[model samples]
Target: MTDSAASPIDRPSFGIALILVGMLAISINDMLIKQLSGGYPLHQMVFTRSAIGIAFGLVIVQFEGGWQILKTRRPGLHAFRGLLVVIANMSYFAALAVLPLADATALFFAAPLFITLMSIPVLKEKVGPFRLGAVLVGFIGVVIMQRPWASPEDLGVSRLVLVLPVVSAITYAGMQIMTRKLGMSSKPSALAVYIQTMFLLVAGLFWIFAGDGRFAEGTDNESLIFLLRAWVWPEGVDLWLFIGLGFNSAAVAYCLSAAYRSADAAIIAPFEYTGLLLAVFWGWAIWGEIPGLEVKIGIVLIMGSGLFVFLRERQRNRPLASDPPRGTGATRR
Candidate 1:
């Protein structure tokens, strides 16, 4: 018998395998950003990622059908989304520099709460007290994680480092709200393409004026002037830098989008957070980065409460979820 025929379990196995690999890919991509951010400009790093992301988006559009998606016309919300990305990318990248990937990502998990809150004003969707309480509970976890007014949990604090996670939560939450509103008029392919395109354009423009459009200063260090002769472009081997980022990102996009389609939000939604565990492991191994007890405790609380919030929301929305596809990254449409 053929292998496929012999191993009937292989059908579902492929999906499970892809999901696992995708999480790893995303974690590694974040690791790359953290490593590169030490030297590269945040604007330039985002520019390069956006440039690469759009290329990937183009390939996807071609596979799906091209100009049809390109033909979309919602310049206003599209522009607004570009602005939101400025906040998301900068805040998230800045947070990644010091915060463990897991911590930064946990803060991102609060994006759903942001979504729920913004829906009233932007989407005009009314949320009852139950969902509102869930949002509050989720934010309580966020505050616990933030540990404002000082907590016994903090290992050490410069104050700035501790606050970034909370800021990341708010910014990412804003990003989700923007995506959801924009998705109403934008095609998935179109939305992805435009966001990347706009970010690339905006960051590129900023870099041009900031550093004469070269994306590298004299030594290429824009993050600080302290590192003399700091900037250096990739050699032959380093060109693979962008390629590596692109591959991991594409894999993440595919897996995450597919996961949402395959199962319920509560079931698979929490699965994406698996990237955080991998992040913690890799961070310790590669960077010797160890978060404090409070951060570690906060990670548990943030993820646990976030998952609880998702589950609670699912229970409330359960009746409507009859074969309903879970949230793909683009909640806009």
Candidate 2:
């Protein structure tokens, strides 16, 4: 009998482990951001984080292929992808300032559904009824999570602020699609460098225009404060925390890239749901906030539907025991 321990199926288990660890690290990053959002401008935080992140990416590039790995033929795609990430980052972090962590995370989980729908048009991938139904169910979960019928959750924040995470999800999905498309020919480290550079540029521009003076007004609006806050010098502890986030950012970028590269996306995608559990834990532990029963139900629905989509795709890809032909799956169309 063959040694199952070394079987090909087991290879992806390592990838799954990397992904889980990455998610946990990222959750810690979010927790820190949530804590600091009240005190610092989002752009300043991003500027600090990206400066360190760029250093980290360059180190990896040096070890991977020594600067040559940074070369790419599709600079425009890289720039566009980086811009999407910046938008997603700003939107989600802005929501973090006002929304409960778990709520923001649950709503952001809709990215997979968005990706599924976007792939049809962008990648020209076929989607069957099962996957489509899963996407619809996932969206319903988003609506429930909003709890619009109830009183406003975040100091009666504007509906526009509440919608930020959903916007983040959409842009995040676009970034993921671009990542998949570029994965065909681009180096992952190069992609990281591009995104980090974009963050640096965005952070600089934000500081230039809004770093001081009248743009810093309106601190009274809780929802807008995170964005409009001036670039104050981060205090000692917060300074250290901001510096640490750079390492966190690089770890997240590298681990996520490594995970997807190691396994079929169908196998790795479901692991993204782990972010919900971590979010819940951090929210309760750090802020004494528990998601209401309705939000919990919404989380279950979103996670279940996303898992179903992955499982369904896996089933479609699996070869049947009785089938002899290997290339006849409808999903291939």
- Judging by TM-score against the true structure, name the best candidate: 2
Residues 242-320, candidate 1: write the lDDT tens digits: 6777666555655654444444445555565677688788888988878666557766766665566567667777511
Local accuracy by lDDT, each model: 0.58, 0.74
lDDT by residue for model 2 over 82-196, one digit each (tens)? 7888988888888889889998888888888888888888777888898889899999998887767867654357677768999999888877666554433434455567788
Report the CA-based lDDT of candidate 1 relative to the real structure.
Answer: 0.58
Model 2 residue 29 CA deviation (Å) reads 0.9
Where does candidate 1 stray beyond 4 Å? 1-22, 120-137, 149-158, 179-187, 212-231, 254-267, 318-328, 331-333
Clashes of each: 3, 0
Using lDDT as the measure, which candidate wins?
2
**Pairs that collide, model 1:** 183-332, 183-333, 219-231
**TM-score of model 2 (CA atoms):** 0.88
